[model samples]
Target: MAFFLILFVLLLLLPDAYVWLSFVRGTSVLWSVLWWLPSGLALAALGAAAAGWFGNGLVRIFFFVLLCVAVPKLLFTVFSLLGRGIGTFVHGAAAAGHVAGIVVAVAACGAFLYGSLYGWKRLVVRQTDIVAADLPEAFDGYRIVQFSDLHVGTFGRDDRFVRALVERIVAAEPDMIVFTGDLVNASAAELDPHLRSLSRLRAPDGVYSVIGNHDYCEYGPHGSPDGAELDFEEVKRRQRELGWDVLLNESRTIRRGTDSLVLLGVENVSRPPFPSRGDLRKAMSGVGAGAFTILLSHDPSHWRREVLPETNVRLTLSGHTHAMQFRLGGFSPCGWVYSEWEGLYREGDRMLFVSSGAGGTAPFRLGAWPRIEVLTLRRGTR
Candidate 1:
């Protein structure tokens, strides 16, 4: 009970603290700086009111924002302390705050606008040919076209981009195509109009997918929000309607004359102690320990925990971080947020590649552009 009381107080105070620090502290000199601080605080209040649920841990982004809100303010304080004495601290701090706000406001706003314009200008389709064999013999050079996070209902509700995205993927004529996850932003309800755009995708081998955390939020009754009111059953139904073979702790085998490639998929995972929804053990149930395998995982951490140590999955494909929806620096941009924001990584014998994702969500992005990837996996003599 005491713990609940303390959390309730923090919940109430977090937003107000943000309000005071943003608007009241800066004296209106920093517009962009003040706007986003409370945007996150507001999101937190909504999340908290929704119960600050942790079944997904996605909502923690708001709290993450609350922490980043202080970065600019703290940067100002540090600059002021460096330049002036104790007597001049207050005045210098205010001036420094105003300056930092303007600089950050311009930088962030510029990047945001640029990203938006970039998203609409053209949604480029990348074609990749994957070859997962060491010798150019069995299945020498294989092509795997990948579609990661398309928040499907994003970028001005534009259907044309989706159509173009599919068109490009189809044009590549990939032997196989896989959608790692984040097929939609909030729910399947927004997908009806976007369905045709999705229908454009076709690969001779097949198109398969795994559920992203967003899908869970929309389909399942969010354990946090109103007892997970989202229609999960409907989400899965829609995935089938779109012609995707959604895999949940399941494996599919893709074949050519005498060779077969195994594709195993599971639910989204960001950190550890994940639920055993289609764990490696069950997915690879009856295979010879050395079967060539490709796992369509939604998060990269799964590679380290399940794929690398436990299973024989040589490659894992995933995309949930969205590079934090914005890339920020040379000094640990990932430190500001979650790990594994973007790109390919290696963990011992296993290889994991994280797509930059395919679209924006909620109309905000910075630094990183939207992307589509073509992974040409060849069996290298490692």
Candidate 2:
């Protein structure tokens, strides 16, 4: 706590310190004071958090947004100014570095503002065609619309935004729809308002889903283990009421005439701290080895840790990472954290597709915007 307090203090004061130094160097006093005003406000916000004046969720969201805006501005301005200061003593190289730093700083600020104001609401459909040699010919041209991480509680006023997303998904004409996990932020109650919209999501082959870590209410308000279990069951019941087939460590065979394929869903299984309820063997128990399988497990890490070496599941879909809600070009800082952060990855004949996710805990997003994924399956060569 002390360490965090010290860091917050530094963050709250650093920009003002830079402004004061600039004022001493003949920058306008009015501009310096104006610049320092936000720092004062941020300091007050932090003090409120420290004093337990704000709700935990509100505090968390406030700090996340505050850091997102302040950190980049602070680093960009501070280092760019430092570079300019160095250029006073050095030569062309330092000046060039300063110029580059300034450009990056401006771009970062612009990106932050655009992302906060627009990116979070902007939804894009990403289409990928997958070829599986072992896929049954009967299932050729099958399309699956997969979306994950709804975190419904975060949708305070995005009802129309969400309804539009649903319409777009339906328009794609998928044979089946899959929600990898995270239908709600913590409890089944979060899905109440959005039920009507969600119920409209339909596909001929059916909508299948699995549990995510958040669905178990482990991160929600503290409650007895029995209460948590009841909430978890309620989530499953809610999904079923919305016409989704909730698969809990189980497999279902989708037959097209004489040929068939397997769809398996395991309860959320991940490394420690994340509940490891998924049992691949149990989920795949009734399936024939020859039948191509599509597995849905919320965390991508399970593919490497268990699925790859232990099973012959041809394709897996996951979405717990959310690419840390940020990415640039093909790069995600989350990539440094999770090897399988987003998009499609392959190993030998097996593949995993990690959606960046459709919703998140925060109201804003940066480079890794929300996605609706349409995956079309093909037979023969991959």
Candidate 3:
């Protein structure tokens, strides 16, 4: 955390320094002094927020402000650098580069502002079909709705979005509903406002959920380790109160007539730096090897690490990546970190679907818009 904070500070400073040297230094003394004020204040607020001096809402605002300031400055620096490099060969290229940098900076500011204000609310439903040769005939057309990473703390007391989300899921008429996790950001209290609205979700099979890394309440400087554990228990208790089967290394069988398929859910599990509480072996303990099984593991990495090699679980649902909450032309920085960042991925007969998540801590998204995923299970080759 300290490394990243220092790196971020440097990123912010380098761009501002470049811009000042290239354009602001020659201006009036007053203009030059005032030029650093916005960046300075934003940095101070962000530092305070990181130190736990501000509430979640204020922290989020400062974080967004920092991003809005840094990104445009970075873009301008890039343009300025290119202009300087080209100036040796072209007579007027340096001045043109400065002009281009200013234009791009303005456009970037607008884009960041729009993303902060409205991008996170642009919800979309991503539909996918999973085909498995061993799927039972009775469960052939099962439609399961999956949503994850709500981070309800980001919503605070606003239940309108949660209510609308419930209505949308109910309208889909799914056979089952599954949440892959991160129900709350830092505390169970964050979910209090949305519990009633979330309780409205229902399906014939059931609504199942598994914990995500954030649900453990260890992300921020909220409290002590013991308090985090208490908050985690409270989160599960509230979800259960809403009629959700909060599965923790457990499996439940959903039967249709004589055919049955196992629905297993494990707690948050991932590589180092993220919590790994899932016990795949315990979760799959009693199941037959040949039975069709679907596993809900919050982190996609678990599918590769445990589910594929150890169990016959044919399908896995996950949603931790959020595609880094940004993408362009089918590319996201998340892919560099997570191989199975979003959408459906297949390897032989096994499949995994990673939702870009229904909500996130940062109230901003670009091309990788927030989404609820509807997956229909088909009993045949696609």
Clashing pairs in 2: none
**How far does residue 251 in candidate 3 sit from its true spot (Å)?**
0.2
Query: In candidate 3, what are the lDDT values of residues 1-382, reduced to their tens digit?
Result: 7898789888888888977886789899998778787678778878676676655776576658666777888888899889988999999898888889989988988887777778888888888889898899999889999999988899889888888888889999999999999998888888888888998999999999999999998756655658878888899999999999999999999999999999999999988888889998899899888888899999998888888887778899999998988888889999899888999999899999999998888788878888989899998987
Q: Per-prediction TM-score, please?
A: 0.73, 0.85, 0.95
Candidate 2 global CA lDDT score: 0.82
Find the 10 residues in a row with the least total lDDT in model 3.
54-63
In what order do the candidates fall by TM-score, top score first?
3, 2, 1
lDDT of 2 by residue, 1-382 (tens): 5897798778767755764675434667877667666666667766675664543356345645465556665766666677777788887745675567657767777777777667778898999998888889988899999999988877754487678779989999999999999987766777777888989999999999999998987656545658778888999998899899999999999989999889999999988778878888999887888889999999999999999998899999999998887787888889886999899999888999999898887666788888999999999885
Candidate 1: segments with Cα more than 4 A from true spot? 1-101, 116-138, 155-157, 218-230, 270-276, 328-332, 335-339
Relative to the unseen true structure, what is the C-alpha lDDT of residue 381 in candidate 2, on a scale of 0 to 100? 89
Off by over 4 Å in 2: 1-64, 91-104, 222-226
Q: Pick the candidate with the highest TM-score.
A: 3
In candidate 3, position 253 carries an lDDT of: 93
lDDT of 1: 0.64
Q: Name the top lDDT candidate.
A: 3
RMSD of 1: 6.0
Error of 1 at 211 (Å): 1.1
| Superior by lDDT: candidate 1 or candidate 3 | 3
C-alpha lDDT score of every prediction, in listed order: 0.64, 0.82, 0.87
Worst 10 residues of 1 by lDDT: 54-63
